[model samples]
Target: MQPLIDEARTFPARAAAHGVNLGPHTTSATPQAMFIACSDAHVVPALITGSRPGDLYELRTYGGRISPYTEHEPTSEAQTIEHAVDVLCVTDIIVCGHSRCGVIDALHPDSEAAPFHLAAGHWHTLMQFDALSAYPCVQARLSDRTLRLHAWFYDIDAGTTARYDPRASTFLPL
Candidate 1:
């Protein structure tokens, strides 16, 4: 905590030296991309994309899950998506899942592990596949061609990345 505090204390000066001016973005944020990623400490979207502060509107969830958007019961994930699309008018939405994901393992058919002790509401939102189809915002945007959606898989151990190909129905190395 002390080390982190020390770093925070000196960050302003270092940021200024690097020409990272926050004045323009202080009033409003206008990120072109909405990055939906897992809540894994190892996955850093800014680092992965080499993006500065206002480049991405990030929405992180446990296992990168995209919960269904119900009119009566909208999840925070849905709200984030709506804000990014409707308000920010983001052009691209990237759903990034990584290898050895805990959520994927939990949902695996072959796994005989005990039920996860997640909240009851969260447990109900968990599904095996078709995450993009389940998301209302994603479907609407894609159909209208107003936004492009990308599904990416990061191989944590292999240090490689793959993109889902709909025609091939498989992930191809990027």
Candidate 2:
């Protein structure tokens, strides 16, 4: 922890020396796109998109699921989406899934054993992929054409990326 903290403490000076200035962005925030990606340490949206600081509004979740919005009890995910769209006015929303995903593996219907060694608990709710497209906020945004939704899959082992094509209902190489 100390080593990581020490490195973090030195990062500002190192970044400054390399001409990385975050001062301008500190006063204002205007990200062009909203990137919803898996909460995998290896799958960094900024690194993947070659984006600089404040270039992307990121929303990371297990399995990259865009959970359905519930008005009675709005989730953090829903709130983030609302802010990204209503406030930031981001035009693009990308949901990126990855290969060797533990969440996906856990949600697999054919798996004989439990995905995790621990208790199921809230993890069971993560299996609801069918409800992803039914989120009210997503529907509204799509209907109004204010935002364009994208689905992507990243293969870690192969170092490949595939984009979902709705017309053909298939994922094609990008």
TM-score for each predicted model, relative to the true structure:
0.79, 0.78
Stretches > 4 Å off in candidate 1: 26-29, 107-129
Query: Residue 36's C-alpha lDDT in candidate 2?
Result: 82
Q: In model 2, which range of ten residues has the least summed lDDT?
A: 117-126
Model 1 agreement with the true structure over 31-76: per-residue lDDT tens digits: 9798888888888888777788899999998988877668788878
Residue ranges of candidate 2 with Cα displaced over 4 Å? 26-29, 108-133
Model 2 per-residue lDDT tens digits across residues 1-174:
999999999998987987777575554668979888778887889878878778899988886776766889988988888888778888887777777677756555455644432123123222332344466666677789987877777767787777777687566787
Quote the positional error of residue 140 for candidate 2 in Å.
Answer: 3.4
Model 2 shows how many backbone clashes?
0
Q: Rate the local accuracy (lDDT) of all candidates.
A: 0.72, 0.71
